[model samples]
Target: MKIKTLAIALCLFSLPFAASANPTLLEKTRQEQQIQKTHNAEREAGFKLTEKEVRAKRNALIAERNRLQRETELLSKSFSKNENKLAKLEEQLRLETGSLGELFGVVRQAAKELDTEMAFSVTGADHSNYDAVVNEIVAAKALPSITQLNGLWLGMTEQIQASTELRQVSVPFINGEGHQSVVQAYRLGSMGLIADQGYISWDGKRHVATPYLKQPENGPSVSVMSQLNESGLQAVVVDPSRGVMLEQLANSPELKDRIEHGGVVGKIILGLLAVGAVIALFRGVKLMMIRQQIKAQLKNPTKPGNNPLGRVLNVYSKAQNRSVEALELRLLETIVDEQQGLEKGLSMLKLLAALAPMLGLLGTVTGMIETFQVITQFGNGDPTVMAGGISMALVTTVLGLVSAMPLLLAHNVLSTQADNIRNILEKQGISLVAEQAEKAGSAA
Candidate 1:
């Protein structure tokens, strides 16, 4: 039994060795279970890692969506701001294109016209903003502001007011000889632009004062325009029509020109005046001498026939023997012959005085006809051609009137003197004839 028990223990020990030779089912299953447990643990660990990765991806998606939403909001705000800006811009465009645009057009037009006016206007030339303002206005797209409009108004008003005023300025002058000089220019409104009594033209491109070809005799004399005061000049000359009217007046023919233009008719009138004056002088001298002789002869009645009264008395004495009727006839014949001598040259003087005016009229008619002829040929275009004839007409008329008045006065004086002498002779002859008749009666 002990052996049997030992063998059984051996067998038990050997059986454990024999079983260790091949894996036990429980051990294999445990091993398989351990491997499965390891696989499961590894899978769970991998799944937990995958879950962390999945969470990270989900968080990234959420973050991306949130960022997209924020960007959308910002874009909407930007669109809203852009729309408001466009609405305001449209309103501004409407305002600019409205009546304000028309007003700008009017202002620009006025500025342009005013600029031209100021260029020729003497009064406001020194204070004009014409060129700069015109350029500014031309480039502008919008209406001018109140300040700009006020400047325009002032420019226009000042120009108008300045044109009416007289002001002096410094200027460069060009003479007829093409010489240039500086001067204190005078602007006498519309009358003339003068400096040192010479006219200047403003219509030319060069702003140079120019002298007339023939200056006026009565220039802007110091006597005409008072001497300049200490404060400023009293007056100046300005050219409205440039130098048209004043130049024509200055170029008008003078007295020397008149004689030249008056031609032959004018000379004839002058000759008559001269002859009438000479004859008057001669007649006056002759009458004075005759009166002296007659007055002396009256003192001594015996003095023979030197003067008219003396001759008549002598004739009556010589006719003493004849009857009263015969004696009267002889006295009448002698008085008539003496009257002829006293009235000598008086008729000629009167004729010349009357003829002078008629001749002048004839000359004037001829001059007018000549002027018309020139007009017909030249279409009245040249004033210079017409001026000569006009001058002739005026001069001849003036000459005729001047000659006639003096000649008429001279003839009247001589006639009155001759009449007085004739009356005296007649009275003396009558007295002498009556004495002779009385003597005859007494003798009978």
Candidate 2:
């Protein structure tokens, strides 16, 4: 009976313990299974969301692609429309080509038919009208190119018709000054106009338009000169020895009459200038004379008042007994006087020398003016006409320099001699006074 009770009690304790463990284990297993289910649901939801977003993005991309396709189609259509417009323009140009050419031809013909006289009556016809004509020819589209030949022919035809009408209407010749000229120019024929001014060809070569003035078999030759008229327009005979045609004319007898008159006037003016030059040179001559007198004094020691040095020596001789202070004062006075004399007219000489250059400059100006005048009267057709003025200009400059150089040398030499004489006078005066003092003191 005791063993059975013990066994039953042990069984009862074990049952409670097992029952508590069972509930706890059940709760743990339920928690773990619930967590697993929750995780699986979350994973499925995430995957579904990802698929949804991907599908949405794909749909958006498809819509965008459709929109781009529509834009591309519209752009292509626009390009086709532009191409059609260009094609239409090109076709129109092709169809109008003939008509435009015919129109240009008619315009050209009308331009040719209209006389310059009629155009003048209409007024405002000039180079601008000609340019319009040329433009019309250019735009004709008849030929592949509006060649120079075609232009020449068209220009000639128009000019002939216009000139003929102008001649009939008594039109005046036009000059550069906007006035009528006396000389009448016809065509560039051998008989009518002498020659057109030769032009530089396309290859930079000179092309003489007129065949009448042919080169001599040997070379170019000039004719003898005749005198020029006061107007400077007459054909003066020229010396054949001269190289150029204009030079011969300039040296012509007719030109010489005017030039000689001018030369005489120039000479008269130059004579006055020469008188002034003489006056100026007188200063130099005086200096030379003074120097010569000094030399003469040295050659003949007996001569009095010949040079500053001699004068100083004479003064010292006369005042040998004087005190050094007095002697020095006298020497200083003598030196002042001598210096004044030596420098006499030097200022005037310098002024004259300076004026020489100025005169030369004046000559240059006058010469250049003359050359420019010739150029203005005629043209730069001849260099020979200009050489005389150039020569005069250069000669004047040379003369100026030649005059100045000698004057400069003379001034330097005179200055050096003056200083030398002054020094000698001073030294001699000092010695003479000092010697006299010593002699007097010793005698006393």
Candidate 3:
């Protein structure tokens, strides 16, 4: 009974310990639940305030949008009123300007034409104020003021005066070697640019110096034009056609350029020319040597081995000092033999001269044939298409003539030298024979 009473006392003390360990089962649980409920209520009230704030912001945006629309509408109405006012002002301007409107249009059109002309003209490029004034006048709804018109007139007058006047200026140019150099440039009455190097011209935007393709005969004379630009006393030949002639010349082919189109025929002609030149040179040197030896033999008359005259003298010496008639016969025989040697290559040279032109003719025929072939294949629509064949024909013919003339001249010269040598030997031998005959007569 005492233990049961102790157990009941322990149970009563343990109830408070259990409640302290588990707050959920005690008064603390009830207090925590109440705090949670109050927090939930506060959160619900905060969310409602947030929703109201968002709706208020949306309404503010809508009001701002409506305000902006009203401002746009007001601006459009103002713009319309101003546009009407501008139209009325422009109409009044037209009435006030009267005939000036047509004049303004005419002035603008002239300015446009002038701008184009000046841009292409051989003068300074990029018109500054002139361009702006032209644009303003073109876009204008009314007639220009007097000052604007005056400026336009003055600009045109200045351009006119400048076009006729010569001006010298320094500019960069590209030479033949593709190097840039600063050269003195002359503005030749707004038609072309003349420079020290060759020809100069405006490339629409900037002045560029370009050389003539087929340089004019006095092409470089234009370079001396620098002096013309600087001094009045300088005398020089002037090309009135300026770049026009040069451009045309550039299209025309030169001899060397023409030879290029002659094809194999031209090559053959050149080969023949080279061979003829070699023959002429050889004959010249050989004949020159023979002439010198003949001169020495005429003076000495002792050794007659190396030269024609010496050989003739040797024939006379081996004549057993025979009768005048017999020695004369031997002299004639020796002269005949020497003459053959002296005139060795002359005939061949003459033949070469004759054949060169014939070969050229052959080339011409072949070239014509080729040209006709081209005509057969394609009608004569473009000259360039048949240029090669035509060039070959003409070039070969020219080459042949060029080669032939020189060869002919050389042949004539060599032949004349040989004939002179033969004549000298003949004269000297005859004189020697007569002298011997006179001595024999005196002894007899």
lDDT of each: 0.77, 0.53, 0.79
Off by over 4 Å in 1: 1-98, 123-129, 135-168, 176-178, 186-194, 198-204, 212-226, 231-248, 251-260, 284-306, 314-337, 361-365, 380-413
Between which residue pairs do clashes occur in model 1? Answer: 186-237, 187-236, 187-237, 187-238, 188-236, 188-237, 188-238
Tens digits of per-residue lDDT for model 3, 1-444 = 999999999998998898988867878767889999999999999999999999999999999999999999999999999999999998998789799878877977887777676666655432334656655665676668787777677767767777677666666677778898777666666666677655665565655565665556765445476566568567544556545766787778776778788788788878888998998899899999988877887789877767888888887778846999988988998899989988887888888899889989999999999999999999899898898888889888998999999999999999899899989989988987987799789989
TM-score of each: 0.58, 0.34, 0.57
Cα lDDT tens digits, model 1, 152-188, are: 7877777666666556767777667778878676665
Total clashing pairs for each candidate: 7, 17, 2
For residues 1-444, write the lDDT of model 2, one tens digit per residue. Answer: 999999999998897677687988767777999999999999999999999999999999999999999999999999999999999998987687857656556655654444332232211122123544455454554543455336535655655554323121111333334464333222211111211221100100111111222222222111111111123344422223321442233354443343333332233334434544565467557666766776666676554675776887677666667776787777778878987876766565566556666666666677778788888887789998787676556656555565566555655665676566556556655675677678778878
Candidate 2 residue 404 C-alpha distance from true site, Å: 2.3
Q: Cα deviation in Å at residue 85, candidate 2?
A: 59
- Winner by TM-score: 1
